[model samples]
Target: MGKTLAEKVWDEHVVRSTEGEPDLLFIDLHLIHEGTSPQAFDGLRLAGRKVRRPDLTLATEDHNVPTLDWDKPIADPVSKTQVDTLRKNAAEFGVRLHPLGDIEQGIVHVVGPQLGLTQPGMTIVCGDSHTSTHGAFGSIAFGIGTSEVEHVLATQTLPQAKPKTMAVTVNGSLPEGVTAKDLVLTLIAHTGTGGGQGYIVEYRGQAIRELSMEGRMTVCNMSIEWGAKAGMIAPDETTFAYIEGKPEAPKGADWDAAVEHWRTLVTDDDATFDKEIVLDASTMTPFVTWGTNPGQGVALGANVPSPEDFSDPSDKLACENALDYMGLEAGQPMRSVKVDTVFVGSCTNGRIEDLRLAAEIIKGHKVAEGTRLLVVPGSVRVRLQAMEEGLDQVFIEAGAEWRGAGCSMCLGMNPDTLQPQERSASTSNRNFEGRQGKGGRTHLVSVPVAAATAVRGTLSSPADLVPAGV
Candidate 1:
């Protein structure tokens, strides 16, 4: 049997295997954040152990830092303490630290790729669930718990049972108005939330091959929501191009050698997967989640699903509960559903390219009356790039609030959150119940879809709002 891309990468990273026990795998990189690293650092201290490979570890303050007022003290004491502790720990452990407002500071996942720390055939672990975002580079990246973080700090390796492999082959080109976000949401709707359980998915086929590195990142970023241990696309020309000039990427002769190795990272012609799924991209449209879970999605032009449509009693009950919490009517057109807010930022779609796409659509369009819109950058570097391109002006002129870089409103960990009963069209991943805030309804959509929703104050697609040329 031929090995899939996941299997190839896993086999290469395995350090040792014992019968009836999990294999000990070497982790190439360990990413840390303020939200989860505090206790792990403390554990290492109490155990009198030093980080085994400080050079391979990195830290940043994101989840708890305020987006505004970079120079001021963090207003929330708990948040301040966490951020402070991370800095102290990083210094004590001899790991590189990107503190709040630092040019390199941002969401850990975003920072990894932007800095070229995420590369093909490597094993990356972070404390954030969206660590799968790094898998876009053809690496095996996944989230780890606090204890696991401590373990990695002390050992620079992880013990793991091998996961099954699944292939999500997206064929054909996507429609004009569809996006990576829509494609992922559509897949979730088809496979349900638990479809990829105990599996590391390898996205393949023509459509997957056509995606940009950022687009691939967006697709893999939500794999956890589908219950996948990790999700990845094989390295190709596009991946190489994106990493070519990155600071940490190989240069000169080393660059040529690295690309040569990355070239062979693709699945072989006869590679076999444990499971396979095929999706047609052309038929997909702008999609949104109407319920708490990421799987409860429908096309923008479609109607909300009724619980009775589900044949399984469990599915029916789940749909009913989701509908009740979302306050959405069954069979009601999603386009006509009003929104209270629009948020455009997160590891899933908070890059410079994402902001540019939304800004292009929002150039002359105004946010609907009474709608609160926020445009946050994923990191300080992304924010600087967006400003240089005047994306901030375009958003501010369109009546959207432009804020600093951080994981804002994505998990409600910061002050940026929705008020009770406030419904929002957000570009961030995850639409779990009260994810944005207590009693806050969330509808996950693409950047363009989010831009159009802000213009119309309802769930909408950019094609419906913008003209043919302008």
Candidate 2:
């Protein structure tokens, strides 16, 4: 049988294989952040071992670093220590570091692709769950634990069990007002959280191809939430275009040669996946997570689901618990739910395209009286580009706070956090209890939806802002 994309990539990168033993796969790149690298660096120090390939490694201070007042000392001592330790380790290990205030500094996943470091057919790993974001480039990228990070640093390779392949082909075109985020949320709702367990999912078909690179990244970024080991899309013309002029992209003859190789990185015509599923994007609509998990989502026009709607005991209990924590009742229109804050930034949807789209949606409209809106770019370069296009002014004029690039409001690690029992419509992924702060409630949304929610002070779609019969 012809090999699937995952099998092909895995075969090419296998360094050693032994019966009853995991295959040792080569790692093309290792991304680091303050939250997970400390212990990995510590392991190296204790072993008196140097990084096997410093050129293949990149480190940055994200997660726990303040997105605002970045120049000032970190007010939280623990956060300061983590950032400082990474700096010291990078210097000692001879790995390049992108500290705060550097144009390259941002979320590790965002920083990788912006610099053209992430490429097709490469094996990338980071000590962060969202590392799957890099898989949009057609690479086998996934998150690793701290111990695994240390292993990659010491050997430039990882021992991994080959994963089965699943094809998630989204056919047809996405309808107007729907987005990549909505599509992903829909996939999760259909497949449930554990649908892709032990498999690498390849998103394809007409709808996937129609999306821009940023949109593709947004789709792959949440693959982990679906319990996939990794998510990928085959390299195509759009992929080549996005990486063409990046800072680290190959130039002249090398560029042509690279593209030629990338073109071959697709599943064979006759290749069969271990599992396959298809979705129709034409029927999709703007979607939101009414409950805590990504799977607990419905169309914006739908009502919050009741526990009784589920037949499984575990599922019913989970729905009940989520409703209790979210302080929502069954049968309530999702659009009727109000919010205290709205955030538009994260590895999932903090690229330049996202910022521009959100800015356009909120232009000339003021944030609702009881709502707080924060527009944070994913990387310093994204921030600078947004500024060049005057997206900052549009957001500022809309009564939103424009902040520097970082993983702000994505987690409780940084200073940007939700107050107790405060609910927010956020573009960031993950809405687990206390994910943003203690007793906080988070509703995952697309950037445009988030912008519209800010203006309406409720769960809303951009179309909601339009006049009747306009």
Candidate 3:
């Protein structure tokens, strides 16, 4: 029998495998951030161990770094301590770190790919849940806890139990207004929050193959939202072109060799997945989360679902609790759900492509009277490129705040948070209670939906503001 893509990658990286014991897998890249690395680094020190492969390890300050006034000292004492701790830890461990204000400094996931450090057929692990984002390069990337982080640091290998393979096949082309965000949201809704538990999903089919690398990243970034161990798409020409000439990408003969090897990373024609799911992309629409979790979403025109709509008792109860927390009612139209703030950046959708999509809608347009829009780039490089293209001016003219790069408003860690009882249309991944701020209700949306919501001050899409033609 042929091996699946995940199995191929896993088998290559397996240093030791026992029939009844966990496999010892070698990790090629270990990315770290301030939020989760401090404890792991401390544990290493307490145990008198040094990072076994500092050359393969990288550290950055993102979650705790303030997007505003980055030149100045961080005001939040706790945030400052975490950033400072990572710097100290990186320096002591001989690990390369991209500190705040560095051109390379940004969200770990964004930085890795933008720098060409993440590539096809590699085993990438990070101490962040969204590490699955790297799987867009056809790598077997996943998140690890602090204990596992320490273990990887000491041995550069992780003892792991292999996950089952799941094939999520998307056929047909996506509608013009629909996006990968909507497709992934719809997939989660179909599968439920815990649907992919114990499985690593490989997205395939014509629709998946046609997406731009950025779009693929957006989908993989949210795999964890559906409880998948990881998400991957086989590398192709699009992947090669994106990595070509990138700073860390292989060059000359190395580039040729890398491409030749990457070409073989796809699942064999006879390979079989443990489970299979097929979705028709033509049937998808712009999606938005009506309740707290990502699974509680509907098409842009859908109404908030009533608890009675669910056949599962637990699902009914979850819907009821989500409604109460979200201050929403069943039968309410999701399209007109009021929003106070609009955020357009996160690891999930904070790339230059995402920015351009939002800019296209905001150009020659103005934000709604009461809505505050924040247009944050995912990285300093992305922010600079946007400025060069004058995308920043487009947002500014539209009455939006064009901010610097970082994970702003994606989570409640930074100062860019929603006030109590406020609601926001965001392009981030999660919508769990208080994910953005205390008492702040979040509606997960695509970049187009977020941009239109900012213009209309409600849940919306570009089709709502711009007619079919000029």
Candidate 4:
């Protein structure tokens, strides 16, 4: 009968509740991007309504901005128009805007946490599906549609039917080469793409507790890919430490008080979930998606699944379609699968920790012939920090192109895209057909795998780069 973390956060944010109708939940923070805010802003104009709480709203240019040129006019007219409209709208609406070239400008999800705007026990919504990234702090964060965007902008609240809760307990220690990315991919493979439908998953247990805040963010970031409304991990010491000195975080006496409250934002001992599942992290291996969807993945050493491997007719057909589109075959080995590019950045894996991991593996090595490597930071702050620590030089010297911060090569919304049929190993979340570019093939990977793949010109891992033994 106890409350789960999601339930607790939801109940606290309810502005109004009515029987047989959705509750109007107060939105603590609203994140907007160029891709989804244009229409919402127009809606506000038509209604002659102003943003109800401009202080609680923020906007950034990511989806449509070019990552390479900081000052050049966006070449694509559609992309340029979108970016321009957001700036004009933000200014007119009095919402804080982080345009390209601003130190804070980056992926909305990345900007939120980097600035300490994402906190525990608060409700956050964005137009991007990866908004669940903020739930790493035990917040009730999820993506909203364009209409909902306008609703939140006008009222600072959202109407919602509460989702069922699911507890995903990851126990045991991860192996040396495994990472949060691998863990999440493995989870998707186990649960299938629709496993978390109509639920907000709360990741728990020993292994989840042991991950860093960055690692936890990576997990929660991909919750949507598995059909979950949101994903979260309870706030703990690690979460507090990460937020301690952040620019938007509380300071001095306020910091202490905030932590005291965040500490209480956990599931009660007897809290019951609509469903529960357990995963043993120690048994996991480096994982990658072979098919178009995230769930069609196997371990790094496993073979591509044949269509017949699926017992269900629909699953079998889906497998066949994915294999054809991916230009892969049944029983094909995942290791050494050739790639044209290796992209090391995204909301899911574009933070400083992710950059450093890729840099460490890429140091003293060069990208393989005919393979292009791109190291894009998640935010301008992360980019500056990476440069301060000389991570840029490490990547540049290793033949990786060091670029400005943005959601490059993540969704192919900008110039950072793949040529037709070009294959890539990327750290981004989705890998659906044409997700990276028209006719492009993407294999979702971790930083280590992405870096190693660049050097070997194939889907690989750190262990593949290292000699069998010293």
Cα distance off (Å), candidate 2, residue 20: 1.0
lDDT of each: 0.91, 0.93, 0.93, 0.93
In candidate 4 the C-alpha lDDT for residue 177 amounts to 74
Q: Write the per-residue lDDT of candidate 2 for residues 174-278, one digit (tens) a residue.
A: 998789999999999998889989999999999999999999999999999989999999999999999999999999999999999888899999999989999
| Stretch of 10 with least lDDT, candidate 4 | 461-470
TM-score of every candidate relative to the true structure: 0.98, 0.99, 0.99, 0.99
Instruction: Specify the poorest-scoring 10-residue window by lDDT in model 3.
Output: 461-470
**Runs of candidate 1 exceeding 4 Å displacement:** 466-470
Residue 268 displacement in candidate 3 (angstroms) = 0.8
> For residues 1-470, could you state the per-residue lDDT of candidate 1 as single tens digits?
66788888899988999999899999999999999888998999998999999999988888977877867999988888898888888888899999986899998888989998888989999988899998898999999999999999999999999999899999999878678898999999998999989999999888888888889999999999898999999999899889989889989999888888888788877988889999999889899998999988988899999998999999999999999998989999999899999999999999988999999988888999988789989998999999999999999988999998899899888898888889999999988888899989999999999999999898888877865236
Flag regions of model 2 displaced more than 4 Å: 466-470
Clashes of each: 0, 0, 0, 0
Residue pairs with backbone overlap in model 2: none
